[model samples]
Target: MKGFFDEVRANLRSPVLLAAWGFMTAMMALAGPFGSYEQIALPRRLIVWLGLTALAIVLATAVRVVVYSRWQLRDFWRGGTVTSALSVAILAPVLRHMAEVAGDAYLIVPPGLVEIAGFVFCLTMGFCAFRHALETVPPAAARAALPMAPADPALPRLADRLPEGLRAPVLRVSGRDHYVEVATAAGVASLLMRFSDALAELDGVDGLQVHRSHWVAARAVAGGGRDGAKMVLRLTDGGQVPVSRTHLAAVQARGWLDQT
Candidate 1:
């Protein structure tokens, strides 16, 4: 299906993320086989070791994503490297065990502590390499959608108060006592009037009510910022509005990125 293909494209586009995952997996597999499996069949040992290692790697990636979502390249690199190193250290024995099943003899290291420490050191090195690779790849910028123009003749006339170049067809109107908030390309504003009265007096736009207090033009959003768990949209002329989590996916799908 078209949707499935689109999803595939999106996944394929994340080269850095994919590379990180791949390297983690390879390290796990290599180290796990080296550390375990004298007691079990090679196949079973391999499966158990690989599966556990993969899970650890995935968990590491998830943790990094959550903690570093907004981090700059320098920070992200440092964190990711640290994460990779710790992950490798933790998973090394498992990898060594798997490798043992394949008939490779591990060094008879003492107390297992030294092996773990070695894992930590190797992991750090691997992650550092990954970060160095990312230096060549630039991150994508954020963007947001803009509102559509309104129709009705009276709406344009009402919007006429704005500069000629700033005029956009009114999409929706809402009331705050005597003032009506209009969603236009120029930005939202309060004009003295009942929102319902203004809607009836306007024409030619299609949009939906976001809430009782606000109606966003279908395209007026440019991008947004996060305030803890909340998303704040930065509109034209530097005005900001909150986009509820309930509507966040919609905003993301519309490709709104903060320009401010």
Candidate 2:
């Protein structure tokens, strides 16, 4: 139950995703009971409209994410605001017409005024979405971005060293303070990094975090064991990392259960 809620929270926390969902919801509300091109039975209309709304939200979220991936957070938010505003403004007619389908005619607002209102509402929603996205970034992310420890009066400076490219590969990414653990042939190495930055750096890697604190290299697993709802990843070096139930299938699909 807790894990389920965490997943829900993570989805809601994404700005581009959440913003797209909101816009899609508004679009559905405008489509009326049966949808854009139909005047079906009341029950059928409600079900179809709701199903399409859900599908649209998912698709819109995916498109926004793919586009946003190439841009920095700031630029993405700025552009997304403009795009969202424009989309809503243009769709006003479709939405208003849908509202008129239930016997009561929707107020015929001037196009100029409707567009202005949409722009303002979308802008506000977009800004709030961006702010929430930034705020959701964990503090440990900052540490991962810069691995160098600052010079301090009480502690001597030490050279930072990343693990040599070994036979074992990175399993997953998780952040805590200034360290990120990479599951490798040797074992888990808690290196200096914020969790978020480390996750971002895993663009080319083929792995996923099985738990909030554990990442498993895709190719390092020797076997697996289970403990109630928790999972254990057995490595070549006799090391094991716990996998949350949430990521159990992902781990198994990576052949974490197969032994050479």
Candidate 3:
């Protein structure tokens, strides 16, 4: 929840989103689409549209954050597409009902579901495309580091998933689509499986699930990588993984920080 809310706060701070919402609200109010023009006066229309859209945006943001944060979605750009589709499917009908109540308390049937859904789908897709087009990089990392620990004997289950050459000790496991990318002393290999399944194979591994999408072996963590306000766990094999706030307490409890 902390990670989700933190993402929401960052998104809400975007000036581009604020401008878009304002413009969209003004357009909806002035044009009075659906049956709104006949049922509402201009002042009332402004208030209704503003409030409705505000609520719509909040719900939309929540959906987007959830989708974008999916452990399997390593490609950030692809996440926008999923987010828009999910937002339209989830928010359109709900918003239409809100419109019905705001306009005339369902006294008259609201806009057809198809109509509302189409409008929302187009708007969301456009917003996602525009937003992603401006992105030059992925979201940055988090704070903290890891301490050195030694690995136990390699388990056959995890070893079988990797290529013969790279089946060394697991340094980290990152989720990507239906696969778990296992990083080891040799290299990273993507095993066809869910993140949970990957972790299950390494049950006795001395590591922590520091993020929804990542699991890091304690021995592999080398300290001293920082990205602005965030702390990134540097690995023995020259990799860095961000620690999500949800796992920060556990990271601390494990005495992983080397603030030195």
Best by lDDT: 3
Report the lDDT tens digits of candidate 2 across residue range 1-260.
Answer: 45334434444565655555566555545554223334444455446556545543443343333333223222334536644554454444554454555433223332344644564356445544654444232344554786644432321111122332221445444454455545443333344566766666555454567777766555556788775676788765455678877887887787775544
Candidate 3 lDDT over residue span 49-151, tens digit each? 7887776677667776686553444343566667767877888888767766655652255777888888887777766666554432222231113332333
Task: Name the candidate, 2 or 3, with the larger lDDT value.
Answer: 3
Tens digits of per-residue lDDT, candidate 1, 1-260, equal 45334433433355665666666655554554343434345555556545654555454554344333223223434656665656665566765554445443433432254565576556555654564444322221211132334533644455643333435766445555455656565443445465665655444455434434454555555556786776776655345566666766666676564344
Order of candidate numbers by TM-score, starting with the best: 3, 1, 2
Residue runs of model 2 more than 4 Å from their true location after superposition: 1-176, 183-190, 258-260
| Minimal lDDT window, size 10, model 3 | 135-144
User: Which of 1 and 2 is the better model by TM-score?
Assistant: 1
Q: What is the overall TM-score of model 2 with all chains considered together? A: 0.32
Q: State the C-alpha lDDT per candidate.
A: 0.51, 0.49, 0.70
lDDT for 142 in candidate 2 is 54
Our model 2 lands, by Cα RMSD against the true structure, at: 14.6
Can you list the residue pairs that collide in candidate 3?
142-230, 142-231, 143-230, 143-231, 144-231, 149-219
TM-score of predicted structure 1: 0.34
For candidate 2, the 10 contiguous residues with the lowest summed lDDT are: 152-161
